[model samples]
Target: MWVLTQKINEREDKNFSRKCLLCRLQFKGCRADYLSHLSRLHNMQLGQPENLVFIDDLLNCIETRLESLHCLFCNKLFKNQTVLKEHMRKKQHKKINPKDTEFDKFYIINYLEMGKNWRQVKNEPDDDDDDDELSNAENSDRRVSVGNWSDWEEDEDKVENPVVCLFCERSSSFDEIQSHMNNAHGFDFTRISVDMDFYHQVKLVNYVRRQVYMGHCPYCDKILPNRRELLEHMSMESHFIVPQMQLWDQPEYFFPTYENDSFLCHLNDHQDDMAELHLSKKMEEDCHIGSC
Candidate 1:
């Protein structure tokens, strides 16, 4: 329950000696040394509130520290939860047997709870049967025995409106389209866009892509063959549009056109002025196209 922010170390001194609040033992050197002492000597239980508070405080005292988010299973560090979640999904971290390693057991439990909370926040259906099926799929040891890419291809072939990559015009299944867009076309869904249509397009693409990847309809729990089918089904169902707009829009998504070559050359030097100029140009183009 104790959420330690990334700024914990900023409050600590560089040459400061640490004293264990529990043992009252004064020690010199880094906070990690003291943490090791606490772990080795006291066998601090992270689950305990009192222990967590002490550990949290101890961690705050370190000048230099490891990355905030880390996966012990893969021995990797991530800058944030978003990056960590993507890594977990790609690596199939949830599919790994926790019983194989102590660290895996501890981390997997926490992550699963986090995932459940996220699903709840999204208002996803709470189906015990679906949960059990997923649990069984993950627990199975034989990875090769699971569903293959050929199954996805077959599903795509059956769909009347197959998902096609706009960038490269490649036909791909719903599950594989997003990865294909990222890896092949270098399409970044996270890009900032000023145009509302472009923004909505990005959101719709990601939303449908995720639903397809999960093998279910977002509006209805009905199973879909591929993302193409899901999109068509959603369209037939008349699912209301709920654009997943970003908190901050990026200006780079708009193609800037300048009235003068000099203005374009010095655009980076005067970002504010260039933004205003670009907006005016965009408005004029929009008006011209609308009149036509």
Candidate 2:
């Protein structure tokens, strides 16, 4: 899918940084620190810090809302600030609502994808998550290691940027991930692509990635309780196969299931080579006809 780059909305004042509007003079110097505080303390993430614009204004808006005894996530009004705080804490409503497009202006993606909101980009027919943190907060009952503020900052990057095997937790760099998938999981994406178009291959990979990540069997509806058991079930049941096209074929699959899995970027290059080969054969055929 071709994105019109020149048309993406422009953002400025990215250097703006000041004291946290919510906290008592915390995060006074760096915006990155401010963002970490929000994520760590409040569980609030207004998208990624790097992709944010007018962040101070965004925080001010949120603070104003809070000062009025309102919940940021639900936007529900309360009789007092103490009541609102309790409501947000009890309901786990510390973050902004993803469905609310009013907050879209604060994110750079809304501008970058030709003025399309990031949510819209996910929903667009050409490309898409239930990618919130709350559901998989503990990585589906994995042991939790409570860490310091710096550790908390590092954890988010690791979670979003992992290049782990689709069937297991083994990780490698982007260049090595495909090889790992093939060697470790017996899943060779390139070999499978000889019979399918690029987009179909994308979908198939996404289907498996999602199912296996969620601890479910991609070939069937059978669900496992966790990643460990799911791996065993798939291996023992011999149930790895392309799922129903209707299930996996989606625009959202065009996106990497993992944020930094640059293997998805490699698929574009793979398709280009096939197209080049086809063009070369056609050119040779034309040359022979001309000589004749």
Candidate 3:
């Protein structure tokens, strides 16, 4: 590990010797990686001397009591600047904050940690199982019986502007509703699964005022009552694998077709093998016979 670290450090240093902006060295390093290292390791050492003076000036900016500046990740307020500075170097804050607009490559990690103390509050086995049961019951109530999940209500209300999925109508909170829409109903997930990333973020400023509803975890089949909790769970574990519709190629949403003998469900194992072989041969022929 030490050897690998040293090699990485040497490579990084050589790269830094290039045109790395943070290092200000004319070596072959990239600006992005250099900036990331600087931001993580030497935030206070950045901007200008004037900026450090500005942060120092912020110490006096408070109107009344001298409460220490808050660390953005943990939201822990320190009594002194030294402690706050030290806290920045700890593993708790080592993870990137996607919330920071300036750092483009930064992301929210430790999704389990992102559960926001909810895991601690409800770590008991019975409580977790109860949560899962409640979620299943709710899903059963809201599950659309239509052929296509997206098409169920889209035809009537398909407008130019994006709206929340019909399933997300029960979400009383704005953030939860948005997450639901993005996860379930936003994309044409019939052909392919949507990327589970949120480009926009809304603060949980009014979380206490808003009643968070429970949602089913796409993996492990657990239930989480909070939207953030669900997102964290998704990040920690595989909620949805990339759609495997291509592996068992039939139609887009083709399940084992039971209606007809020609369809997949009615086919025996030997028939399935023959069908696959035919498909492979056809694919090979297509590859050979390229468009003229």
Model 2 ranges off by over 4 Å: 1-162, 173-175, 252-256, 269-272, 281-292
Q: Model 2 over residues 168-223: C-alpha lDDT tens digits?
A: 77765444776887776667766767667656766677778778777779988699
Tell me how candidate 3 scores on lDDT.
Answer: 0.35
Query: Each model's TM-score?
Result: 0.21, 0.40, 0.18
Candidate 1 residue pairs in clash (backbone atoms < 3 Å): none
Q: Which prediction has the highest TM-score against the true structure?
A: 2
Tens digits of lDDT, candidate 1, 1-292: 3233322442253454866522335777654555554443333323322222233443442212223555423547765444543454344342223333332222223343554532344466566776545555466744654556677667534533244653234664434654675565444332422233433433344454444566566445568776677656656775423333341133432222211111111111123324546766787789999999
lDDT against the true structure, per candidate, is: 0.42, 0.64, 0.35
| Candidate 3 ranges with C-alpha deviation above 4 Å | 1-29, 39-69, 99-292
**Selected candidate, larger lDDT, 2 vs 3:** 2
For model 3 the local lDDT of residue 22 reads 18
Superposing every Cα of model 3 onto the true structure, what RMSD results? 27.0
Worst 10 residues of 1 by lDDT: 260-269
lDDT of 3 by residue, 186-255 (tens): 4232223122111100011011112123365433446787676765675667443332323222232222
lDDT of 3 at 286: 97
Global fold similarity of model 2 (TM-score): 0.40
